[model samples]
Target: MEVEGLSVVYKRARDRAGAPDAAAVRDVSFSLPAGQTLALVGESGSGKSSVAMAILSYLPAGARREARVLRLGPHDLLAAGEGDLRRLRGRRIAAVYQNPGMALNPSLSIGRQVAEILEVHLSLPRAEALRETERLLGEVQIREPRAVMDLFAHQISGGMQQRVSIAMAMALEPALIVLDEPTTALDVTVQRQTMDLLADLQRRRGTSYLLITHDIHLASVHAHEIAVMRAGEIVETGTYAQLRDDARHPYTRQLLGSVLAKDPRPEARPGAPAILKVEGLEHGFSKAKRGRPAVEDVSLVIKAGETLGLVGESGSGKTTIGKLICGIHDRQAGAIELNGRALPTQFDRRGPSDRGAIRMVFQSPDATLNPAHTIGAILRRALAIAGAGDPKAEAAALMERVRLPAALESRRPAELSGGQKQRVAIARAFASSPRLVVLDEPTSALDASVQKEILALLVELQKERTVGYLLITHDLDVVAEMAHHVAVLKAGRIVETGATRRILSAPEHGYTRELLASRLVPPAATAPARPGAARDAPWSAVSQLA
Candidate 1:
């Protein structure tokens, strides 16, 4: 596949006179050789996805595509007719999207979905397609493919759903695969495993890959040639070593620097008092078929002006534990004490003062925030609930704390970017001036550079307010950087607990070691020297979120 001088522009629904029309991707050029991977790296809105969509002829309506030359094999992609492109898409070139939840049909069985792909592209009989679907599932390392095929999308785990998505993409075994941020939402261990599966398949089948992501570390490890994109243009393109050792562009250097730097703040503040404590924490969902507790025997403490990092894989009870302490879930058997006073198991039983003392910043800001309400209105509501004087004054102060412009208070959640929305969520949490805040994957949805800014703001807030944070996340590098102490959770229990540095440098548990080993940054000594090199990075920045 080869592309030169490719450009794309989206026609506005209602364009006025003198309105500037900007191309999403402009004059981009690259060649993805057969049996090799080319990764396009950039932040969100950098046009990486636009280029991929253009190559697949999957651009949305109202988007115009232009290119000097865009060829796959002997065919010109830009000039291909709709019918030809449709036939070529699944039979010759395929794509795997980012979110399996959104990609998969919830109402359809996993087996039916995968089999449908085979049936449509290959025109195989239903029985033959079903059999092939099982084979594809097995190839992707999905355990008990026959049983899994009968389950719905919601019935399976996130990692499993992602594998199913990959299996669907590989149904026809196309010549090229466009993987757009395939493992961005997965846990570190799962992400590594999925990548390993892709690499193994590529080796065996010689399928070329065009990986589009914001993770520089992942691009360095998996891509044969790395293209650093900025504002729809390719700023630099070279091998991982060439870009890593000597980045020519300023943006590339900035990306490299952000990936390299870990924990800008000092570690371990001595002699701080415990602000929040949990004793004999135990809870389980009644409807759980596996019978394992969602949270079991979990005990930890968050000291004032410090962070307690809770790290684990998805379904390992990290978020469950956070929700339990923050009054979102009732504890089955445990004591949650905030500053020497015990908190009610249910939030409704707690008094206004008790409720105001402990706050939570959820993983997805869009879920917590109302689209209809302005930022100021959300902040004012929280202040009113806390019985704070002057909602308007407090809202302004909260916005200032989060480093958001005061004028943004009038805008609704839809008006803000992902980063800005997150800051609003943070500000809302701090409206009550809580002593302890439960930060549940606060930076997970943000871009790398924006993640840095949010982290810096969080640390700065900690410095000013001496607030304690219960940081629940699957990201170990974040634990190392932000948390003073770390607790590793698995199957609703603590696998390891100690100082962040001690746990990271020399983890006693095998799972802990595996988690660290699964980081996305490749080591220097064993770096691959070939164009089609395949390796892994140290456990660090995987995608947009550094």
Candidate 2:
């Protein structure tokens, strides 16, 4: 596969016609030999994904693409017509997206989704397609492929859903596969397993891969060649060792440096007052098979100015426990207390004070923030609901506290970057002066540099306000950086609980050990410790480039 001088531009909307058109990809060029991987590494909005979309002819409407030469195998991609591109898409080239849940159809059975590709591409009979589908599923390491055929996507675990996605991508044996952050949302163990499956399949089939992601560490371990993209252009390209040791471009060095920067773990404040407490918490979803409990016998405590990391795999009841405590889900059996006062089981049942004292931030800020509302309006509404004396001034103050510019107050959520949107979400969470905040996978979608900045902001806010945090995440690295105490949860039970350093360094539970083993550390972490190169660099250095 080869590309040279590829550029993509999207037309501005009529209302914004006065502004210049957006250049998503600018003069990007790269080559990937058969059976090798080339990684496009950058933060969100850096044009890595635009290059992929342009190659696959999958750009959205109003987008214009131009290229000097774009060829894959014997096909001239640039010359292919719409009909030709359609036939070539699933057969010669395939794509696996970041989120499998969004990529897979919820209403369709997993078998049908996988088999349809075989039938369309290979023109196989119904029975033969189904048989091939089962084989493909098994090849991707899914247990009981036959039984899984009848199950809908929602019925399977996230890892299994991703496996099904892989099966679909592999059904036609495409020569080139574009993996866009394929394992970003997965657990550490699941991520390792998924990558291993991809490697094994590549070894067997000699398929080339174009990996697009924000994780320099992941790209370092996976890609044969790495290209650093920033602000719609490729700034540098080389092997991981070359880029890591002697990068010439400042942006490239910043990306590498961000991954290597380590933060000191917050010390446990033994004398801090307990901000929130849960006892004998239990909750079960009605849709669950056999009425199984989603979370059972869960009990934890968070102290003022401290964070408690809840680590686990998908469906391990981490989010369930968080929701139960926040009154998002009514607990069947449990007791929640704030400052030694029992709280209501449901959010609506609680008084305004209780609601104001506890707040939660979801994983996807896009889903939580109303697209129709401006950032200032959202902040002001929260302040008014909390009975602030001056909602307008307090809203601006909240924006300032979150490190956002006051000018962005008028912009809607759609106008903000992922990092900016998350900052808004954090600001909204603090509007009510909450004593405890439940942060669910807050940094999973962000790039390494932005993630560090956001974490630093959270720490600063905690110090100023003495707020407690219940951080739920699968990223152990994040846990190490943020949490004072760590609790390992599996099947709704706490298998181990202790200091973050002790649990991460020396775990008592086998499950905890497995999670630790699956974590991917940067090469710098294992090498001789060097001074942090980007620690002193302003956050805007990365943010503006992104």
lDDT for each candidate structure: 0.85, 0.87
Candidate 2 to truth, TM = 0.93
Identify the runs in model 1 with alpha carbons over 4 angstroms from their true place.
Answer: 13-19, 260-267, 287-290, 529-546
| Model 2 misplaced stretches (Cα beyond 4 Å) | 260-266, 524-546
Q: What is the lDDT of candidate 1?
A: 0.85
Residue range 1-546, candidate 2, lDDT tens digits: 888888999999999969999998888777777877788999999899999999999999999999988999999999999999989988999999999999999988999998888888889999999999999999999999999999999899989999999889888889999999999989999999998889889889988889999998888777766889998988888767678888989989888877633343857667998989898898888854675588888888889999999999988999999888889999999899998999999999999999989999889999999999999999999999999999999999899889899999999999999999999999999999999999999999999888888888998999899999999999988898889998899998888998887887789999999998998865453442211212222211011122
TM-scores, all models, native as reference = 0.92, 0.93
- 1-546 per-residue lDDT for model 1 (tens digits): 888788899875564556767689888887777888888988888999999999998889889899888899988887789999989987889988999999999999999999998888788999999999999999999989999999999999889989998898888889999999999899999999998899889999989899998888788778777888888888887777877788788998887766634442356478988989999999988864577788998899889998889999998999888888878898999899999989999988998877888889888899999999999999999898888889989888889878899889899998798899999998888888889999999988776777778877888888899999989988876776688888999889999998887888889999999999987765373566332554342111111211
lDDT of 2 at 136: 92
Which has the greatest lDDT?
Answer: 2
Q: Which residue pairs does candidate 2 place in steric collision?
A: none
